[model samples]
Target: MSDEDGAGAGEQLSDDQKQEIAVWFLSNAPAGEIHYVAKDVRALLRDEAVYEAAAAEAYPEYNKAHLVSLELPDRSGDIIITTYGELDKNNYLDPRTAQVATVDHVKQTCTKLRPAADEELPSAYIEEFRNAIDMELSKYVGEAYPKGVCAVYCTSGKDIEEPGADFGLAVVISAARRSPQNFCNGSWRSVWTLEFSYAFQLVEIKGKIQVDAHYFEEGNVQLDTDIDRKDSTLLQTPEDTAVSVTNIIRHQETEYFSSLEESYLNLSDATFKDLRRKLPVTRTLFPWHNTVAFTLTRDLANELGIGK
Candidate 1:
């Protein structure tokens, strides 16, 4: 049941009395948040359950303001690519447009179901898949060097401990490029080499997967010319070896609510009527993308039927 219709503190404050106080308080006072301290207020006006409902009705603008205050930011990323995964509905944004404004509500659930038994591939097929990747990458490496280097790694959400669900695949493609440098008054040509790294990520959602590919320029790295070639081996030094690195794509995880009890307050009709007679009417306009707060004084609280 809503807090408004719920039972109040004991037989001292009946539902009718609380409702009457809430209605009166709302009508009398200017539209704003009203706070009453139990110790400072009278017994009749001490309960706030009735006040909150009345305030919501009398001051809809205030409630809307409170709701908007909980909004969170949208998710963004690099070039996205998906193969088996889809992004039609299940994505970073929630399906319900109305609840989008709610802070606790998420846009999409990144839960992936297990593939059907028939859809599963054999171990040999999986190994072949890995080999196929190596073959495709080898085609891009310069013919001068056959030892083309590439790295593949996996990353997952904080909650994922094993290779179960919500896993991402990252591939770093490092290719060699050669350019000639003029030295000794343009008489000598120095061959300088660069290692271009291209990175991409595959993230699985409910029915489909989402892929984000990094820009070529952002992942490129220039390496030392290292061109003392003996046979097919381009030697820089014994200590110099190409290293493969994986770029991790970061995203916000879903936030869960905790089960805990807490006390909150609002204003009632009778209290509002009393407030109208006692407190001065204050007015303020709300903005589109901001939060506003105010403090009601003791004298105002007392006059509004808050206490003696």
Candidate 2:
């Protein structure tokens, strides 16, 4: 009933509208047949003709009294019907609006860093760095990727000895997007997933901080039935008798990944430079250095077995 249900988008349907659709389906859709087997009567009669005559006489009454339900078939047609039926029932939202909102939500709330519990580095300094990185990444949200969802997670080492050297930090970023594209008279949903793992190192030279980073990126995309399928036979191959959703997903995964690889490459390059620039920088020790000196001193004392 809420926006969070069913793909996290789409308008809520009124009770009247929902009831109307249900009634239409029950009245017009295919209804399963109900057959009554009079086994005991047939055994007692011991006459095929008598049993048949009795069955024929009682058939109309039984049919009128029993309930017949509409059930979807257990094949590809069911999939296509259910998918589009739900969308129409809920008054599905526009794909473009859903895509943009999803990306914005990810940008605002998905960047996170979790340092080890035993880390000896000053928490304040670590938090400052994380905030800085998150801020830098925010600028690329709607720019580098016009539509998609992205999340970033960073983990740091337990012991960081140097202020501006490699500290065993690792960052992983995950991104995805959904698109509904028209095919013939119907539509298909294309979903993409991209993951990037970065080996991160920091360097400071002449009061300026820089990032020395290398990352490995991989991506996958899949397509699923979204709307009407006029000719189900079109989805099947000459050698096959039925449509295989698994094969369709796998084949699209490979094809779309290759086609979209260039866009992801551009995003990666732009992000690397953004990290290097460390934009909105202040003179020496970043903008959060006002109290970092004291915190660093305390950390050093604790490391030397002199302070708690």
Instruction: Write one digit per residue (lDDT tens) for candidate 1, span 161-269.
Output: 3332332322332221112121000000111122211121222221111111111132322111111211111212111211111101101000000000000012222
Model 2: per-residue Cα lDDT over 39-102, one tens digit each: 5445645666655554544432332121111111221110111111112221211111121111
Per-residue lDDT of 229 in model 1: 16
10 residues in a row with least lDDT, candidate 2: 205-214
**lDDT over C-alpha atoms for residue 154 of model 2:** 23
Q: Model 2, which residues run further than 4 Å from truth?
A: 1-122, 158-165, 180-308
Model 1 residue 281 lDDT score: 48
**Per-residue lDDT of 81 in model 1:** 14
Question: Using lDDT as the measure, which candidate wins?
Answer: 2
